[model samples]
Target: GAGVSQSPRYKVAKRGQDVALRCDPISGHVSLFWYQQALGQGPEFLTYFQNEAQLDKSGLPSDRFFAERPEGSVSTLKIQRTQQEDSAVYLCAVQRGFGYTFGSGTRLTVV
Candidate 1:
């Protein structure tokens, strides 16, 4: 894709269900990041991947949240045992020259 792409723009998950969000970044962009954004709040950093290596995951809220970019061009943010607090907009972004290009995001609603 020409820009960052995220799948399942909206999702409704049952409590304890697992969900996997996908992100396809622009070609040639190496730095990728995942963020969780709650309503009316700023995006909170979740994880960062430089190419195929995950360099920073300290921002991840818990062990239930995991992110990977195995092939470097695409990434996934997976949530195991979804809970009410896990509901948020999952945003995928790629670093550009001095900024970032973000996907529209996946809105997850855990019930």
Candidate 2:
């Protein structure tokens, strides 16, 4: 992947449905992770991955939220048992020096 790409830019899930958001980072990136952004608020850290290893996931809000970066090129964020509070944009980013390159994000709406 040449740049960060997120799939199904918009997602609508039912109250109990599960959803998986995908992110493909640049070919050689080896640091950092996911963020959840609510309207009128800053992005909140969800997890971090160094290559294929998940070094830190303390930011994940609950057991129902899971993330993985298999093989280190792409990543997936899975949300189980969707709730109204889970409605937000899930962003995938890679560490680039002191800054980050973020994907367009997947907007999840629970109805």
Candidate 3:
């Protein structure tokens, strides 16, 4: 079984630009989640999905953030009009019972 993996592991974006971060979750996992972690802070849940259904997205910070798991396995987070405040680690995790397996994350830097 493959563990969750994220690409780039880092990103730098100019203000007002857009960026896309990718995540590949563990095979056979049915639940996935996205979270944003700011420096010196805990991860804040951004969105969640079960299979192909987006069950919750209330934690998305703003309209600039969008996420999707169209095929129920791979997921992506897109940020539009990136801002300096959006510079943070975007983490993807897959649920397994009481625990979750997380990716290293894409560290976005907006300058």
Candidate 4:
């Protein structure tokens, strides 16, 4: 299988717009993770899944954010009522071998 892949490379959302960010992991990987990184800040864990079972979702900042990996292959991060401060890079990673493979990330901007 290839490395982790994320889509929409870039996104522009007007304030209050809803968005879904997607991530496709390498086949056979058993663990997946998502994070949100604000400018000049390190990535903040958003969610984690192990074989379709959502193991952790402690870092989601508000009720407006949600994530799921129903079949353990593809995952989606949905943000409702997007706000200006919601702009950042949304990242996904999959555990592979001894480490993790990460996606290029989705740069989100809200105006």
Q: Which candidate is the best by lDDT?
A: 1
lDDT of 4: 0.92
TM-score winner: 1
Model 2: clashing residue pairs? none
Residue 16's lDDT within candidate 3 is: 97
- What TM-score would every model get versus the actual structure? 0.96, 0.94, 0.95, 0.94
Ranking by lDDT: 1, 3, 4, 2
lDDT of each model, Cα atoms only?
0.93, 0.90, 0.92, 0.92
Cα-lDDT of candidate 1: 0.93
Candidate 1 has what TM-score?
0.96
On lDDT, who's better, 2 or 4?
Answer: 4
At residue 87, candidate 3 shows an lDDT of 98
Which residue segments of model 1 deviate by more than 4 Å? none
Question: Which pairs clash in the backbone of model 4?
Answer: none
When summed lDDT is taken over every stretch of 10 residues in candidate 1, the lowest stretch is 1-10
lDDT string for model 2 (1-111, tens) is 237899979999999999999998855788968999998899999899999999999999999999988898889999999999999999888986797888889999999
lDDT: the better of candidates 1 and 4? 1
